[model samples]
Target: MKPKTPRISAVDLFCGVGGLTHGLVRSGVDVRAGIDLDPSCRYPYEANNSAVFVERDVNEVTPAEIKSYVGGRKGYSLLAGCAPCQPFSTYSQSGRSKKRGLDWQLVSKFGELVSQVQPDLVTMENVPQLQDHEVFEQFLGNLHGYSVSASVVECIKIGVPQSRKRLVVIASKLGALEIEAVGKKGNSVRTVRQEIADLPPIAAGEKHADDPLHAASSLSEVNMKRIRASKPGGTWRDWDPELLAACHRKTTGATYPSVYGRMEWDAPAPTITTQCFGYGNGRFGHPEQDRAISLREAAMLQTFPRDYKFLADDETVTFSRLGRLIGNAVPVRLGEVIGEILVEHVRKAEKGTLRPISEELSGRLF
Candidate 1:
């Protein structure tokens, strides 16, 4: 008879609405707890996963505190952190300083906790642009004792219904590690229609009577006219001349064509951002609707489960808060891929079939 596989446990930092935790749990990892600075995340994170939520900033969390949650587990320990990406995002590049910024420092802090706790596995997800920063190098340096591999993964390749890209890093102290490739273009790619077309329709400035969370924000008279003229796969260029914003007429703003656009039903969505509920932000307008994609639709594009609840019965939904939580989450599909990779690595190691870094470097590890 085969021996039972040893259980793997995890502690998620900056867990944010528990997207990573949800995916990991689905992939068979026993996630004990999640740590985050946002109190708003407590409800959703705790509600959806088996883990407890610790509402504390990553910077303020000590190794002892982290150990309290993960220490008693009997098997492999994993630490996962998806630090905020805004500091290294292309949109914020011009203003970022060489000196460590707050978000960058959070990545460094993640390294600190990893060094102290010395978990069997470590994984991090962040903007692809973070690969260019010095802090990333330092974080890599801190993992010298472990075998590490990283890649910039496209979200759509991993079954997410959006064209988002993220930098993913995985390291293992037990043996060499390799993350499976995802986001291959072909019949496997998920589309906007497949992700959200089934929802009962709701008009602009309205909420579904049965599901209040399936609500869209109100649009002003002028903006409503602009959305009416927008086309799927087309930009503001399709709008009537009078409906164009003044900034769009200028040469500088002419480059920002994705704003005031609509998603193509047959293709993946543009990257969902914190402002996705606004018609003027990216190509967030529903393909056939007269308003921006609803908050529920935005979460769906991020690969969150359709019934994933962000608010409670008595809690009022606010566009800004929920939008940020949803957009900032790691796509649950990508998290599953990560969890699968780690589990595979451990399985191979136990069976004595795992390849060393030197042998696997050329074939895997981007």
Candidate 2:
């Protein structure tokens, strides 16, 4: 009989609520553990994934600690980091990031860990804006012996129901590795109508009898009037002068028209943000409902399983905390795509059939 193939193992860094870990498991990789600093994430990450949740800052995590998670039995070792993107996000360009004390060197720390651990495979996902920074180039410099492929990927093209653009980088010591192309030709883009159209409808401030996450935030009397007059896919520009906010009346605020709008039923949702639960935050209002999209709908748009657990039996469900967790999660489908590519890369390497990316292009960021 042919010998059994050795198992593939992985450790997820900055794994918020196990979005990436769950998707990697779904694609057949054994993710041993997920590490994040937020204690609130512990219940959801461990409850939803087979992996253990480690609450520690990534800067303090040593190579030995990462290896200990998987023990002695592993054919391939993957170190995956979807570092918090707020530091490199386009939203930060307005100078508010300075006040948040955001750590810009975390990506460099991730690279330093990779150099120390020297895992067989490494993958990273972040906002597309990260691709332009010198830190990303320095991260690439750390992988001295790996063939690397990096690109900006559209989440909807990979079956995610939101219009999120993320930078994905794959590196391998075994041989060349490229993210597998998916959602071509016959595969239709996932739409908002397909994801949340069937849910039991609830009005503003109402929670479903059985599901707490289905609750919507309460709208004020004036905001209720504004929403009632809002049309799907239409911005605050479509509203009457009486319904417009004082800020919207100013020349500066006129540029920010995407807010106070409703999502279209037939199209994919705009990128989910931490403030997505608030109707005034973005075009987050429900297509037909007279309220903003519920927490459950946001998670579904992020490609999480409809029944995925986010809290324990005794935990209280708060919109602010849950919204941040759900919004910050890596879309699960994109994680699955990375897993598929990694699995195939290993398979080809074992057969000595893996192709190497050209040296000229390997160092270039797409």
Off by over 4 Å in 1: 1-6, 91-100, 179-187, 356-366
* lDDT scores of the candidates, listed in order: 0.85, 0.85
Query: What lDDT does model 2 reach?
Result: 0.85
Models 1 onward score TM values of 0.94, 0.93
- In candidate 2, how many clashes are counted? 0
True-vs-predicted CA distance for residue 232, candidate 2, Å: 0.6
Per-residue lDDT for 1-366 in model 2, tens only? 843343679999999998899898888889999999999999989988888999999999999998887547648998997988887665445665573245557788899989988888899998887778888899999988888888888788778988999999988898766334333323469999999999999999998878888889999999999999899988888888899999999999988888888999999999998888999999999999999999999999999998998978887679999999999999998888888777777877788886665532444222
Worst 10 residues of 1 by lDDT: 178-187
* Per-residue lDDT of candidate 1, residues 60-148 (tens digit): 89888878877877778899979887776654455567533878888999998899898989999999888988989999988877888
* Model 1: per-residue Cα lDDT at residue 322: 91
- TM-score: model 2 vs. ground truth: 0.93
